[model samples]
Target: MGTSAERTGLPDTEGISALPADVPAWRVLLSYVRPHRGALLAGGVLSLATAASGLVLPLVVRELIDNLGSDGPVAELVAAMAALVLINAAIGALGSYVLHRTAESVVLEARHHLIGRLLRLRLSAVERHEPGDLMSRVTADTTLLRVVTTDSLVGGVTSVLALAATVVMMGLMDLTLLGVTLLALAVAVVVIGLVVPRIHRAARHAQESVGVMGAALERMFGAFRTVKASGAEDREGDRLRGAASEAWRASVRAGKWEAVAGNTGGLAVQAAFIAVLSVGGARVASSAIEVGTLVAFLLYVYYLMPPVNQLASAVTQYQVGAAAVARIQEAEALPIEQLGPLPRATDQPIPSPPPRLQPTGTTSAPAAVTFDRVSFRYDPELPVVHDEISFAIPPGGMTAFVGPSGAGKTTVFSLIERFYEPDTGHVLLDGIDVQAWSLTDLRAAIGYVEQDAPVLSGTLRENLVFGAPGATAEEVERALRTTRLSAMINALPDGLDTTVGHRGMKLSGGERQRVAIARALLRRPRLLLLDEATSQLDAVNEAALRDTIAEAARTTTVLVVAHRLSTVTLAHRIILMDAGQVRAIGTHRELVTNSPLYAELAATQFLATAG
Candidate 1:
């Protein structure tokens, strides 16, 4: 099987922790806008109309001023000016509402895409990245896109158009005043351009630092009980504080640059307003322009300030948004599993499929598993875990694997499940390459209980039905009875519906193990792989579950990885492994007499007696 990185054509993330800058930030920013273009366009049109009304208001006021002493109706002129003011106010409010609403939609779409991508990411890729850092990208980073799509994208266009129109209106009144305003604004542009790139770098660092803080906090919570037992609360708190302080430093730096850009625009606009006023007053005194024209041009100069300031703000927002987009793009670039047929993302709500009816009985024909000279290692730098090892298990039998720590025992289970592909050679199921089988179907045929027997946070029923959502009531009862969990469930406050705390913490270790086994059993798989599945069970429960396993072997292939001799003594065959190779294959009695390692392990660890 091809490695996930090779198959997906994504660079192995093991060595590349930094965000790649290969894609242009602008292109990433535009991609987000493409999906919401219709809404953005509508908001932009409204914004433009608002600007148009503002532009016309000055002209209306100018008309009122010029006709003050004329025979024309003064009351009518006042009414026209009043109407323009109300129109401008109403349109501006509506436009703002539209833009803000669209901004929220952009955020929603980004989060949906990002969450979907993260969930489907390859296991290797996920293991390489921190969970909290990925979470920061989903929450904080996606939030930044809202402002970028609205203010930086659509609002930026509106500001530019309005600025252009205001300049034209000023020109019609007086070219001299327009030139003065433009010259003053030019210096601010030069200053702003010099610092804009710095904002992007600063903002990127700030976001990265926040992720670091989140990672630190998550680490503490994951081992909360251990930290308390070890009395390392103060030490861990200091570490979290250090991460937060670093984030604070980076955020302050970003804010400083943004303030500089925004303030520079305000300063430039104010200077331009003063220059326009001084020039227009001189023109009015010289009679080169009428008092009404001078007043109107001054109003136009005042109007120009907002758009100019807005343009500056938009640029600064883009820099911050681009930093976030770069981080988001890096996460999206990680390799993802190509699990069998799934739905493409869409805006429409997906209707849930009707519950699938599962057969009440276990599979009639058990599956045969084979490993063909397979070699594997988790990483290139690590020592090989399996060195050209080969093994086979026929259908419908109980087999046990016994090995010392680091002897590649659990790796066998992983290989069978294709969690990590073999570095060389093949793993086959019933003579067909496992890689060739559909992942969904291949997994459906195998029931795996991991070494930890992890249980998710949910109700007792949810955990039991996780692997088989459609298991019939009778099947559920049978599994519970087989696992000796009937008494525990009957005693619960809500029976099967009782809530199990996080990681099933509310249940005892042994009960959690039973829940995990029962969950797998509900699937009625042909090949059942149990890795230390009964390690936590007491003697009575262990013997009962062992009998259940012996019975299950009659109908399915049962493979167990165990250290206890009692667990494997009755197996039809046992494979003893040492260092990455199979040392001996025989019944427990045959191995006890023939293999020195097996005899030593049985006598020392398993407390076996040679009767």
Candidate 2:
């Protein structure tokens, strides 16, 4: 849960390392390449052959030039030169194709591992990061690996082979000229080394700034309606624009450093080319070297230019990709949730067992739910949300928790559903410690409907079966009838097949609530937890909703966290809370007389004066 800054691998321009930190970037890059090494090695060998063939082309041309009018067959020399040219072009194309395909395969591998880890990450880990920023890592960051594997890594490799071959050949032709060439290139190397780290820093800053911008945009979109209604569009726009400007500035800075490095490399290689020619020309004039050999050495000098320039470009591209890989590494560093008895992440997928619900049985069993001195806080630094508070709801009855906002009423349901764990005390369900039960089984045994009563973007049938994937058609009809949704479904043009828009925005609040209710009922859960399920409904729908809760309680336990007291006045038992403590627990009529806080809430929130 520490900051990403503490672990992000962006301090240097080196590639991402999947191994331990001591192993270094080269080894890390090799690990990703190792999977596709066969293809990469073939491509690299072919690329080396292409460079070698290119060197031979100049030799063929030099031979043609020296033997133009000689007794030697000129037609055969021209044919040989033509063949080398075609061979160079063909090998270059084939090598590039193989490397490019390998890069794509690497990207797929990285994404699959990243996504699997992301989906299995603990809820707490997910909560600490922004959805949009994480999405940027999954998508934008993964794309950068392609350039790293293909252009930067492979290109650097082939450039080294070409540079080494060219240097060796140049040395053999004229050692003195090669020495001068090396001295000139050394100045460029010093200049490049000085700026490489700066380029890395700039690129990392740019990528991080872009991630911040993405997070800002996600925040704006998530609360778009609120922003418009509050007339805060200008404020929000300025905030997003500020984040964008930061990214732009960092990118421009990175580009400036990259340009400096590229120009330095180009100028150095060009200077070396000129120096080699000047030295070789003088040597040739004094009969120290042959004219044909000088021409071939110059061809080697030209060949040296591309590898040097390519190495420079590759280094710059590598810094950019390294920046992206750093971001991806930060995301992958988090621990994934232990899905079951066995971990979910592996080279081969593990088959997950079906959720086993606790069987509903004899009425003489312990209470369906119990909280023993529970204490919780969303953040350790913040005030406690639940303070050593405890309560129990027996089976087969509607129990309502009526309280003001921030009283931790809704938190109780969250604890039971285990969206989070209590920091200090135990939460039990049907006499079993919840910590001892399987997360899948514990959740499968309870059905939860949030305050918003979220409906997914899918067909009615899909939503109905979401909680209970294996629910039967008869089960669906039974839930619909109980939730009083059968009438609504019959009126729709597509009935159960009707498409619900995003977050079920296509349906009214009442309809969405009913859909959530039906979905929960279809699961045949032993306990139903409803958090302000009727808070947004009109009087008629609220009344219907209360009746529906009552109907559901006939066979199962119903726990209600009520915002409006009238919705749960008829509950078998009422627990009144204030701040994070239960103030009173009894029948509504009993609490009305005993608890002053409950009475105040009834007068101010539950009962407004007659219209």
Candidate 3:
């Protein structure tokens, strides 16, 4: 799969382009600021006040020097100086508070919004995108946003305000000196113009590198056990190191550009000060400018250095922030799955299907699921996984799909769950098109357990109640018993409170499968789909699972993709599949007597075990 940078064709610094062009990146960034507008306003005002106070100090110093003897009280001059220091300190504190608060809020909101979008996104979109890249957005990219929000914005604002105030103070002292300062500042602006975009591009690349590194790490860790077992740990380590090195190189490039911007600004400001002092000194000596005014003007001119430096810093920060914005926008731009409104019960409810055929009578009659000439292909250019596949499971019964690997058995469950829409034909539920029903409603009506039996990192009780949050403790215990996991639960030191490690790696395979079954059972789904849940289990474990499935089928219509011959034998009817097509349909005994492929498979399994 192509990396996000390669796919989007964005420069490394530009990050992902998750947002539409119609939506301005600045607008999205500013949205985070909206909630704390009042705080920001106060911070800005404080910064301005500090700048104004800084301007007043030069004037005070000029007066104090000019009226040294008998023109003013020394105590008054001392008091004014002390007041300026106190005011500046208070303003600085206020500004810091505002900036810090804003940064926290931005990070918090961005994380929450991104996570929510990720959860709501379609499974297909997630499958296509790398999890490492997504993780980068949440972790590394968001951290950059924090810097942009607090330090960048605050520094940029203070710099501009201080520069403007300094310029005005210099003008009051001597307009000629002010003109010289402004001219020097203009040169610095040109230098900034040349450098800002480079910084932007560099910063973007640095962020992209982080994402790439993250993706690489995720791939390595996702299959850590397999990689270790295959003796490929050294190779995986080298790959991750390469990704980290790339990120480091990109960051260095960005830092180099930032250094150029800072140094260039500093040099320009110093040159401006030299020109102003030389020219002003000559004017004072010639009596063209007052000595007091010359001294005050020089002070103001010196003050311009900070603003000039700040302007450069702000420009660099803006570029970095823009890059961060692009990354965040890309995350927001993923295609999210749209869930419809919740279904409401009507006074005139739809009539129930026949009692003998009814799958479950929990809330209402179970919806009948039918795949009418369904065709599906994961890749558009590749051969279909399911080709013109047609099947119907009545309201209630056990229907098993039996086939070898690559027969597209699991694809059937994916289709029924609407995880992937069919390329052709329609999937109907209770006579209505599957798409017509809300995603939530469709999924709520069906329970699916995968072959690997994925379990989340949480307590045993948390995992049990995950599918149906409202499931009572008694209900949880009952479901555990139904899945034959009660013994495992009893054996655990923490029982229901035991924490399952990442992907439930802490538990045995059989324990994880049972936990998954218990979770699905808690949902009380009308249609239960098991995708070879017993494929990886031992005979004893498989028998226990079979009993659990049998119990579940009595209340819910169970459709299983069978891997073992024993599992197929328990099915009321078997749909024999081959190369994405249903080749035969009959009981195991009937298929053995009639279907040539079925008989061949049974004979092969029996012979292979005997040998």
Candidate 4:
């Protein structure tokens, strides 16, 4: 019952979630940790206990020094020390196993969340992002959560606790020496704090640059055909090289920051060592501290450095991980359209609605789509594609839209398909306002084919039945025969099983279009919208397409965007569009006599020449 935001990666918040990016590093890390509370607690306790084992070495040393020559108890002491070491080693390993297991789970959950979010994103939102960049963020950025949660996050806490215990032990052994060491180490702590943020910033920049490189390469390769045709291989390669170089530079910058952070801890530890030696030497000479106690105190002092250093290193790692979190969080913040208005992650997800069935009663009749004073545009600043224009295509016959390019012929189809909402006026489908019909039901009744009629890289049968997953084999054959794909299928080595290649490049333009038509026909839709369905067809194929349209029209409505007017000259009716308005509507002769625009379109460049 997870809401769309939960099912997807979106957080339960309004607007682009700048919060995960802007929140304190600890808070953000804690959010990921919260899901594995029991494991974190158990792992933390084990890690702390293991860290305590280091203190035992100092005690064992002190005991050996104190018991020397008194009892030749070396064997017993050695055995005891060895036992402690084994236990510590075993505990630390188990803690590591638990933490890393939790880390892997976090990474998996994050990837699933991001993939869901990407899929649920509105069509327009997805168009804004490069597929490669989004892909990198999902695959690469989410992995960072693993290290952040385990090594840097839990490990850092354990290091701090161990460091605290060591400092206390050192202070008990000798207060003055401990104070001197802390003073010197204070400088290192300050340095680490200053440089750690730089590491984070550098890591962010590096990741961003990598994403940019991926996006650039994806864009170039997506249109590789055009690039190869234009012979821009060298230029495109240089462009990709520049992007890669930028990524390299950014990574180098992050490396520089990491080096500085690591060195700060080393320098602090070195200076503290020197200060403690000087102070402790004076105290031993004055007989203020015993030799064994001094040795034990120094041992604790040395023990303090690793955890101190680990804490610093963890902070630096946090910066690196934080940068990745920012990218992931940003994607989660994008507006999700399918969550309904004011979409937010919630406890209950909106389930897919049940299919809508056409009403069947003596009083109810099939719907004829109507546009009443519709006005629409893709961009608000741009001119309207459909300008307060209206038309009606009654059901039960083939209807053809004929017009020049950009005359809003396609816009009409777009509105009917609900790809874009009209700025004003109503688009009615079947006696009811289109806005009232649920999206699922509205789309369920119609079959649409674009001008290019794209086919995915798969078996021809897959492309054929894509719209109608439940269509039987006989239904598929019937569609192939009607759209003239049966002949091409016979030539293919595997017939309907042949690979179509990317965008169906393996098939000819005409065959691809026929495959698309066949796919639409298999859907058995109440309304079929085909844009330029026969534009790529030869005379024989075009005649076959026209006959198929006429036959399909007997049972359901067929709407086609006619490119060659002569092909649809015998259609039941024609809606002639000019400059986003319905200039005239009639049959071939009626339009030729009544509308000059229609006559010119039928007798001129596109139609007459093609015919």
Highest-scoring model, lDDT: 1
**What ranking emerges by lDDT with the best candidate at the front?**
1, 2, 4, 3
The sequence of per-residue lDDT tens digits that candidate 4 reaches over residues 189-233 is 888878877888889999999899889988896777889999999
Candidate 1 Cα lDDT to native: 0.84
Question: In model 1, which regions exceed 4 Å deviation?
Answer: 1-21, 69-72, 340-360, 608-611
Sequence-dependent TM-score of model 3: 0.90
Looking at model 1, which ten-residue stretch has the lowest summed lDDT?
Answer: 345-354
Q: lDDT tens string, model 3, 292-355?
A: 7888887887777777877787778778888877887887777786675223322233333323
What's the lDDT for residue 22 in model 3?
Answer: 48
After superposing candidate 3, which stretches have Cα over 4 Å from the reference? 1-22, 69-71, 151-158, 341-364, 605-611
Cα lDDT for residue 284, model 4?
84
Please rank every candidate by TM-score, starting with the best.
1, 3, 2, 4
- 444-554: candidate 1 lDDT, tens digit per residue: 888899888988988989999999998879889999999999999999889999998877878888999999999998888888999988788888999999999999899
Candidate 3: deviation at residue 367, Å?
A: 3.7
The reply for model 4, stretches above 4 Å from the true place, is 1-33, 339-367, 490-497
Off by over 4 Å in 2: 1-31, 341-367, 458-462, 472-474, 477-502, 608-611
**lDDT at position 441, candidate 4:** 66
